[model samples]
Target chain A: MDMSVLIALPVIIPLIIGALSLVALNNHGVQRILGVLGTAAVLVAAIVLLWQTWLNGIKVLEVGSWPAPFGIVLVSDLLGAIMVLLAAITGFATAVYSLKTVRKRFERFGYYPLLHLLLAGVNGAFLTGDIFNLYVWFEVLLVASFALLIQGGERAQMEGAIKYVTLNLLSSALFLTAIGLLYGLVGSLNMADIAVRLQQVEDPKMVTLVAMLFLIAFSIKAAAFPLFFWLPASYHTPQVAVSAVFAGLLTKVGVYALYRVFTLMFTGEVDFTHQILLWMAVFTMLTGVLGAASQYEVRRILSFHIISQIGYMMLGLALFTPLALIGGVFYIMHHIIVKANLFFVAGMMYRLGGSFELKQLGGLYKKHPGLALLFMIPAFSLAGVPPLSGFFAKFILIKAGVEAQAWWAVAIALFVGLFTLFSMIKIWNEAFWKKAPEPAIEVPAPYRNTALYWTTGLLAAMTVAIGIFAQPIYVLAETAAQQLLEPQRYIEAVLGGAK
Target chain B: MTTMMAILIGCLYAAAIYMMLRRSMVKLLIGLILLSNAANLLIFTVAGLERGVPPLIAKGAETVVGGSADPLAQALILTAIVIGFGVLAFAVVLLHRAYEVIRTDDMNEMKGTD
Candidate 1:
């Protein structure tokens, strides 16, 4: 009933499910119920969190009754709430989609348990207030993701998962090392506490180095620019449902953390970090769109676009204004929904034409117009077409860039949007409009005639709904931006520093 | 005693990083072990290297030391060590699988594949 419960519920319930399934790890029927129940509960919880945060302001749920600086705190600002909601929605959608996909697989119990664990990690990451606890949850998800990413023992899966695991393991090391240094220097792990303490110390540059270390770590996780190579290589090889949720979910967490840290922990004297972030944003946008260009494979393009879209989010960070932050927050929400829908549609394409390769795939406009309509809405939104969620988000960002008089960034971002349109069109023309792929081709059929369709449709519908109702979401983002910019509110909310 | 422990830990770090750069998977696993041990030593050093003094702080004592060993960092180090072990085990399994699947232990062969 309390607002704080909104934050804990999404994380705690799935963990409870995981515990239940672990106790019944041998029972297939029990695992099935756990999977559906865990994911649905999280989804409902996330929506509740969003509604509560919207109504009563940000919610801080301290793990123990201890004070904020020492206790692990889970604070759900509008930004955190939005991320939880997206993670929860995609999480449920993926759970539904995976049901049929994993039915014949030998390890359904293990699969559902890992899935629930992943949700817990994701929700915790979104909600946590302490920087050290962030590290803990990051590990929780990384370990779970490592296992989940390699669930199937096939050659391609192994190859892809190896790259994924190796890259992320290195990221974990970097993250842990940074945390050690931060704890050593500041002697506090709480984000709000650190923010306050960091100011009392005169040496801002040392803190800047610390911030840069974290930036590199989170950037790698988000797959930004130079650190983005692992994404395209591995993402396309996974089960479509898995890849869909991944595309929808994981990197957004990275972006979310980056935004949170920069706004909350490194405010006022972050010029150096912002400058570096600006250049990376430009490079990330260019390189990501370039990678998307000429890519024949469906998921490869989607993965590359993930990188580019992260650029826009980074742009919001680098620009460092209320509006830009709003743009960043809104962009991620738009991206999470649309990207997930695209990947789900790609799954559908895999079913129809048997390949995500643009060369092999063709006109689904005739065979599956209903699906075409669903895919087009998200795809068009991603391309920033008018009246879509993508347009409003990008509009705010580019306008903010212009207002900042960062003309070059605005131009580049706009051009990247065009190139994004080009890539989307390529997918459209090749995968949906061109002649259908030969039927004898060997790409395995995706599951249809079941819950997968409804789940995918649900995700696609969210993409549309966000577009149509952009006003309220924009208002929410503005509040999140305001809370982040000041940060005292977040600190006080968590610490009773206000009280 | 504290200074000597610091020196020993520094040596471990140097040796572990050296081993980590090796091309052999077995050596890399060893490197992880050494690196983690070095990290444990650092944790111990930070928590204050006491020769015979206990880790647990007594409510009343004859000594008047400014700071006791930080229980939290020690707890964190314990968690880290277990996580490191889990990761190392997973890596070892993966190495063995790679050997069985591709019939090789050389890291270079695994390169440039994906």
Candidate 2:
């Protein structure tokens, strides 16, 4: 297959599937089958794309046959390929899990179509080589997520959607403003072209100013520190399938943008820019974990943990070393799978206990040992327990921090892990170990759905597999980090010897 | 011209921020519109304003005539405006739905989720 066609398939597959699913709107069964098949297809394509990039280094496709630096391009370096692969995994898992969990009402309301549209937006964001195109893709995902969040249009969903919409709109506005300033400064929208042009610009201060604007704009999107209020307030309001996908993919797109811009474009003032990122990473971790500790609801706790985990991933970028970037990439991969699996497990808990409120739930350990085991895998991994994927990810980051002599960051990272473990244990003790509350509700019939268990088990097994096979993944991350740290290779690959 | 535009953009931004801080959701929408327009104008002004010079090339010319306007900025603004309109429309509809369900125009009333 041609490289250009292969690079575009990750996006084209989802776009075509979403459009086709729209035509099959009235048929829920058809939409469900199409959703699973669509994501599965993208998963396979992502594997091929990753393999091609791995073998050949960076692959760039100039759209419409326009020359590089003038036309939009799709560049797949190792980091982009890894993210695309991770997104496909989460997308496929959520699609299969939705078969059992998503209601017929939602399915008829075009759930599968919206899900695929969101996937297309995500893959486009991961693959696009132009900065402005990234903005367009962000709006795509935002719109799809907005529709997904308010699916049933209940009072609670509307309430949540309002916060989600308003905050996201504000962020988009800022992002657009920053993009305008960047284009004004660099005279280019292609990220690789801008990276080349920016080095010749006379005003480093102006460049830093625009860089800060991008940081604040993306920080809101990424749910970092004070800007993260919208995440917890809204993420738990959606259906489990929707929230699981959002948890796994949406905020990570923001983090990926941050990583892309900071490494590739804003490196001239690293001490200034990354220093700010360091502080944000610290407070984001502390506040997010503390917030999770205070939440009593199952999904709410997980939502806050999502914010905290974002801190760990950001810390890798903030450190801005090869080893640190590797840890960051590894953390992103591990977190996407583990977090989505945890959300799936939460869905199952609600199935059996009929409540997300911890006070109303108990005795799941005695009732369903298998479910308990499923929960333990992701939960322990999330808490950074030894031999789990999260452990290796965290260990490498801490080691990187120590090597970089960021003592305070290392100390805070350790404490955050402890607190994360505390929150996980809290869930275990309250939801599984404690006796059943009075008037225990009967488990729903659909709780026996094999598809749900299979999907969740698939992700959990991935978490364990990643932990057991850390060496190879570590090597991949190291290569990705090397590519990220060196921008000239990326620029050359994208521009094709033009500059 | 650039100085005038810079002032106009600043005013729009100030008004946008002020309106966004209001209690009414309608004001918030207005704020968002102003914010996006201000951004578009900023791009237009910063990309260097020019007059009566089309970005088109004459027949058999290799490149655009000298001092022609930068077409890329206009293209970017067009795209941004389209995206902004879509997002604003969505936000307006979402606000309307929230008002219908929550039965309040004040943004404070929707704080139950928080």
Candidate 3:
């Protein structure tokens, strides 16, 4: 009834269920029930929590009877709550989609538990108030992801999983090192505790070094420029359902952490962090788009765009303004829904045809009109066409960039938008419009059309809804942005003195 | 002592980086182990080395600045070292399978999804 339970439950319940899911290792039916029931519960909890946080201010949950700062705390501020909400939605959609693909047995035994555990890790990272605990949850998910990534043990999966594990392991090490350094310097792991104590640390160089360590760790996780190579190479090899959930949700977690830390704790420590972030944003945007354009594969192009879109998010972060933050948060929400939709479409494409290569497939629009429309709406939205969620995201971002007098960032984002359009169109033209391959292959795949029908319909509807009623969502994003900039509110709530 | 530790750690890190750059999965595994050790040792050094005393204020002991080693950081490092071993175990299992299935430790052949 306190509403904060919803926030803690999204993590706690899934984790509990994840543990329980392992018991049903021999019973796929039990695993399926646990997985779907657990995630659906978490999804419902996230929605209710978001609604509650919107009504009330920020909800804080302290573990064990320990007081805040000393005991670990989970805070569901507007931004974090919204992040959980989007993750829950995308996660649930993928779950439904997975019901069809992940074989009944795998669902019951391994898939469900790993999936729920991953969600728990994601939800926990979003909600935790303690920085050390954030690192712990990150490891929880990364380790679980490692298991999930290699569970099937396909040669392709193993190869990609190796890169994924190595890169993430290095990043996690850097993250912990940074944490150890910060703790050495500030003697506190709570985000609020550090923000307060950081001001007392007089040496600017030490501050910059600590901030750089954090930036590298988060940037690598976010797949920003220079640290982005592992993403596209690895993401495509996983199961479509797994990849769908990951594409929509995981990298955004990195973006969420980056935004939370920089905006709240390191706002004052800006000379090096902000400049490095700014240049990184520019290169990330350009390189991401260029990467997307060079590829002929639908998923590969979309994969690359994930890197580019993160640039826009970082641009918002580096700008350190209310509007820019709003744009960043808004883009995150829009990206989750649209990106999940696109990947689902890619999965659907693979389901129909034997391959995702544009050269191998053709004339999808003729066979599957409904699927074509499904692909069209989110694609158009992802391209930032008018009246869609993507447009609103970019509009606010460009406006915020211009307002911040960040013309170069604004220019790069605009140019990237064009390339995004170009790539989306390329996917459209090559995968759907090009002629059906030799011999007019009949019944290309069994799973294709069913997936295409349900997924495309659901995602396209959501994109349109966001486009139509952007006001409420915009207000939510602005509120979340406002909460982030005001460290006192977050600090006080977590440090136990205030509401 | 600090200089010797720093040099040893530096060499470990360099070896780790070189191994990381190699195509063979086994070499990469070795590199990760060395790098992690170097990192752990660096953390130990930064925590400030001391000969004795253990940093615990046991029952009205003399309160001196250099009296005990920083036990908290030591405990943390111990925990970190254990976790590093767990990672190594997982990596070995993973690499063994990678070689079995892929038939080569060369990462380039593993490129691109099937």
Candidate 4:
């Protein structure tokens, strides 16, 4: 099989399934089956793409047989492939979990198709080599997410969706403006071509200015420090399945874009740009953890933590060293699984406790020891406890920070870890260990859905597995980091050695 | 021509930001539309203006001759315009639904969800 076809399959499969599911909209059963099968197929294709990229270096596909810089291209490097695979894993888990959590009415109202479209957009974003195409993919992502965020049409969902849509659209406008500026300067939208042209740009300051534009635009999407207000406000309002996928995937796309552009296209002004990134990383970390500490709701606390963890990933990029980039990649992979699992557990907590508010919830440890046990795995991992995925991720980053003599960053990273632990313990004590102030509202047996538990358990197990067998994944992250730090290979692969 | 378009885009952006700062959600929508147009115009002016030499390749020519307008910028703007329209339509509907349910179009009042 052509490698390009293999590379394209992950995106194509989901879009086809999404359209098919929409055509069969009246049949909920068909949509459900299609959703599950579509994501599963994506998962399989992503794994193959990853394997192929690992074996054969970066794979570039020119759309319509047009040569490199002139045509739309899809390039898969190790980092892009890894992100796609993780997205597939999360997408599949959400699909299965949604079978149990999403109501039938929501499913009927194009939920399944939107979910697939979201996956398609995410996959496309990771794969595309053209910067303008990336913007289009982002619009695809935003449009689908807007619909999905307010799927149930609940008052709160609508409120959250409004903020989410408006802010994201603003981000899109910023992104488009930046692209226009970049295109004007470089005369090409191909990412590799831009990278090549950027080196010859006469005024580096102009490039830095555009880089700042990209930073601000992507930060809004990534939920970094000052711009992250929209995340905590809106993330907790969606259905658990939606929130889980959003938690795992959405902000990470923003981080991925940050990683992509900063490493690949914006390296000329690293001293200036990365210094700014360093400060943003510290502030984002502090603000997110502090926000999490103050939050009383289960998902709200988790939502804040997403911002905090994004700080760690950005720290990796800001450091711009091989070890730090490795740490960033590993942190991203670890955080996605751990964060999504935590949200899934929160959904189950809501199922059992009858409320998301911590003060109102209690005695889950006595009622469902198994549930409590499952929660502990991800909670501990998220807090960077020893021998878990988060711990390794944090260890590498802090170690890199120390090596770089970035004492302040290391100190803040360690300090935030402690606070993260505190918040995790807060959830544990309030939601599980504490005695109920009143009789637990009588409800049918809690969380008996096999699919829901399976999804959470699978993600939890992934966290544990990544921790225990950290060496292989670490090696992969190291290779990915090496590729990012040295972009010659990426550019050469995409442009067919034309440079 | 480029300077004129640049000033026009600047005015559109200033107006957009002003409206976006207002309390009404309707104003926000208008602001978004204006901002999007500003962005499209920015792309247009930045890519440079050319008189009616269409980008179409002449018969027997592999590509359009010199002095042809940059079609890529126009294509980009078209895509952005379509996306902007779709999102604007969605935002209008979303705001309408929000108004129907919340009984207020004030951005401040919507903070009740927080």
Best model per DockQ:
2
| Residue range A145-198, candidate 1, lDDT tens digits | 777776666666666665676667666666666666677667788988888888
Chain B TM-scores, listed for every candidate in order, come to 0.79, 0.92, 0.88, 0.89
lDDT score for candidate 3 against the true structure: 0.83
- Per-residue lDDT tens digits for candidate 3, residues A312-355, read 99998888889999999999989999998899888887777657
lDDT per residue as tens, model 2, A1-499: 5676788999999999999999999988789889999999999999999999999999998888788888989999999999999999999999999998899999888899999999999999999999999999999999999999999988888888877888888888889889889988888999999998999989999999999999999999999988999999899999999999999999999999999999999999999999999999989999999999998999999999999999999999999999999999999999999999999999999997788999999999998888899999999999999899999999999999999999999999999999999999999999999999999876666535699889999999999999999999999999999999999989989886455
Count clashing residue pairs per candidate: 0, 0, 1, 0
iRMS of each prediction in angstroms?
A: 2.7, 1.0, 2.2, 0.9
User: Chain B TM-score in candidate 2, rounded to 2 decimals?
Assistant: 0.92
Interface RMSD of 2: 1.0
Over B1-114, each residue of candidate 4 has an lDDT whose tens digit, in order, gives 888888899899999989988999999999999999999999988787999888898899997788877888999999999999999999999999988988888898888556
RMSD of model 2, in Å? 1.1
Each prediction's DockQ against the real complex: 0.30, 0.81, 0.41, 0.77
lDDT score for residue B100 of model 3? 88
Judge candidate 1 at residue A27 and give its lDDT. 84
How is the predicted docking of candidate 3 categorized under the CAPRI scheme? acceptable
TM-score of each: 0.92, 0.99, 0.94, 0.98
Please give, for residues A1-499, the per-residue lDDT of candidate 4 as tens digits.
5767788888899999999999999999999999999999999999999999998999998887788899999999999999999999999999999998998989889999999999999999999999999999999988999988988778888788878888898899999999999999999999999999999999999999999999999999999988998898899988999999999999999999999999999999789999999999999999999999999999999999999999999999999989999999999999999998999999998887788999999999998787899899999999999899999999999999999999999999999999999999999999899997586665556555788889999999999999999999999999999989889989999997444
Ranking by DockQ: 2, 4, 3, 1
Model 2 clash pairs are none
Residue pairs with backbone atoms closer than 3 Å in model 4 (clashes): none
| lDDT at A279, model 4 | 93
